[model samples]
Target chain A: MIDLMQFTFMQRALVAASLTGAVCALIGVFVVFRGMSFIGAGISHASFGGVALGFVLNINPLYTAIGFCVLVAWLIGWVTEIGRLREDAAVGIFFASTMAMGVLLVSLIKGYQIDLFGYIFGNVLAISRNDLIAMAVLALLVFLVIFFFYKEFLLLTFDAEMAAVTGLPVKWLNFLMLTLMAFTIVLSIKAVGIVLVSALLVIPAASAVQLTAHFKKAIIYAVFIGVVSCWSGLFLSAFLNIASGATIVLTATAVFFICTFLSPQRRKMRRRIGTLVKTQNS
Target chain B: MTTPVIDLQNVSVAYQDKIVLQDITLSVSPGAFLGILGPNGSGKTTLLRTMLGLTDPFDGTVRVFGKEPKKLKRLREKIGYVPQQSHIDLTFPIQVKDVVLLGRAYKMGLGKRPHNQDREAVEEALELVHMTDFADEQFGRLSGGQRQRVLIARALALQPDLLMLDEPTAALDVGAAESFYEWLHNTHKNLGLTLVLVTHDVGVVSRYVTAIACLNKRLVAHGLPENVLTEEGLQAMYGCDAVFFHHGKVPHLVVSTRDPEKT
Candidate 1:
């Protein structure tokens, strides 16, 4: 463990893990509160399609992933807003179709894709300096937008109609929200891998909500949980020589279960049940 | 005479083939506690939304504070609106104070945090709703009646000239519902604010509101409570021979013979 710092890849991996964990959790707070978990799932899967397209075009997969994911995210937003179909049902259609596109696009490449597996099951230790820089830049962009429009996002999630009534540009803001989610996915996708990206986006926030009544605190706790589990998972995966993405997600999932047990809401329900039992006995 | 707070002229709203509201011409004067009385799906909510410019009217103009609602965006700042079903996202992680602080978002503008005045406004609004003690509690942890009060406080924190409430007590029990009306009555009297409440309780409308507008896709009657609460007005709005006679403890609409239940 002492010699771990000597390895530059370990240093880069730790930094990438921290960046991916915190940013994904930040956006995850809104995604979870909005109950748009499926949207995140759909966007992340669409990112896989982007990567496959990038491989076929012989270009940076990151750029194509951004293009593909943002378009799909906006399309899902439009479908939900138009009231033509239920939100999950619309996202479900995109979720399955995009993955199929990704599968088809990957097959179009004549030879085995060398870098494909890196994205599917992420290799954080393999992160280069440029990848770290890209992750940092994207994380900063997500932070700036959320900082400026924090109030608007809060109101939109709490009650969109009320936000619209208060003269806020609800439609444009909604687009901006989808765009942010896309950027966040692109930011962390390379390091966390495609499959574990949505889990990172959802789990920490889910755990945070169980413990706190305050939204701000939930964000804080989510980031805290995210960073800790990310660092530990990276360390444990290295020591045991296991899959890093799966280890991190399992660690976070375990934390979520623990949070549920300690949740104040659960305690209240327990008290109610205890009284019910007493009444029945009497 | 003072100018009216809200004025509409021959407004019609449609969703594809269905007409939600039609040919509605109504004006509400200042200091008027008006009740929009109608059954479910009778355009009571649509009429309210039209006045707020949430839904566009296919014909005629909807003016609030003497200007078109869509044109005068600032009109929203002067209007406090508590929308229907205030208990949205009960499990959303938010404190009651933060929920109330959202009402002050317009004044705070973009990228700015709440200053002293903003905090004071939140405190004042919570105090007005009598939920000051629960300011730090989770909004989801509160009872249904308490949640409604907190939502009302959120609207009141805006410090608007006109107030609108849609089915404020729809989810509340009888005891809580009565208290909600009493609180609204006091708020109207003390603030002297123009209030438009959408409700279907004919008896409560007669007892509390100064004026009434009965709607059944179209405006059936619009006048003083005494004039609009008659049997003819009731029948026109509800599409049945509903008599306002005393059968139970409280006087309510009793449907007699020849009743046609419309879906």
Candidate 2:
């Protein structure tokens, strides 16, 4: 175990994975609560187009991915607000088109297929010092925004109409949330790749929600689950020679299933069903 | 005259080319319990939205607290709004106390948590709604009636001068609806708060509201409930004759039906 930390790549991987996990899970809580899980999935896939474009244009994929993700986030927000289409429908439209572009761009690439594959499937061991810096900066920004606007976000997620009537800038805050989500997804692409990034965004938050009835508690639990799964999954992957992203997602899913069985809400539901059965028999 | 809490003059609202409200004029005085009655798609919600500054009128001026509706940020502090209960996701993992405490968001501003005064306000609101015992419980675990009361309590925590509700009793049973109205009446009387309710139930307006505004894309009638709730007024608003009767002190309306044989 100590020998693993001796490797600089392993040390970088650990730091990057933990930061990505924490930030993605924090944003994930809002996603799950507001029923924007599809948006998360959409934005993450949209980043693939950016990555492929970067490869073709010989630019840093992360930067291009950030730009692409932000554009898609704004598009989703705008379409949903215009009331011409449902949010899920907007998400679906972006999801398919962006991925289609990404596949087309990837096919056009002459070489560096291996490098592109790293972003598509994620290679935690390949995380550079600059990538760690980007993740740190983004994670800091994300945390600060959430800290300052915690109450506002809570109210918006709970009752957006009430928030708007109370003079909160509901539309701007919505765009801000989506933008933050896009940045978080872009940052996590190094740890989980484009395809698996949404799992990190949703699974920890979903698991946390099952365990708690309060928003604050749910957030704490989500961050905890995210960090734990990241660290454990990284170590497990390194030891077992498996994929880090898949391991982390599987770990988070396992926690979610366990929480589903042990949650108070689940017990109450079971009791409700038991009484219904008994009443019918009587 | 004392400044009206809400005053809308010749306000017309449109979504794209479709006009939802046309040349509607109304005023809500302080301490007035005004119920707005309208048929489906008759702009009752658009009226509420215009008053709250959530929607811009295509024409005419809207005032809340004697100022332009959009420029009433300070005035908004004195206003509490409870949206339709159906809009809320009940299973969204929020505690009752937290839900009520959201009323303090504007007061707290950015980066500020709920202080002692905010907590006290929440507690008082919970007590007013008779939900003090369930303050720590999950909001989703409560019954439909209880959830409605909790939503009201959330608004009450704002210590608002005017409380507005949009179809609050839609999801409630008869007993719960009565109790909710009773609670509103007491709160209005005791707190001296103006209450604006948008509803389709004629009984609610006829029984509890001090003033009634019948609207169908426009203001059909605006007066005391007994005067505004006549068969002719209801017919004009609902596009059909409706029978009005009183069960005890509460007035009810039943849509009229004509049989071919009778005709």
| Per-model lDDT | 0.87, 0.89
**iRMSD, per candidate, in listed order:** 1.3, 1.0
lDDT of 2 by residue, B114-187 (tens): 89999999999999999999999899889888888888898989899999999999889888788889888988
Residues A142-187, candidate 2, lDDT per residue (tens digit)?
Answer: 9999988999999989888888887888888999999999999999
Best by DockQ: 2
Model 2: chain B TM-score vs. truth? 0.95
DockQ, every prediction:
0.70, 0.79
Clashing pairs for predicted structure model 2, backbone only? none
* Per-residue alpha-carbon lDDT of candidate 1 for residues A108-227, written as tens digits (9 for 90 to 100): 999877688888878888888877887888889998999889999999998888888888888999999999999988877777788878999999999999998889999999999999
Proportion of native contacts kept per candidate: 0.71, 0.82
DockQ of 1: 0.70
Q: Candidate 2 local accuracy as lDDT?
A: 0.89
Off by over 4 Å in 1: A271-282, B246-263
True contacts kept of 1: 0.71
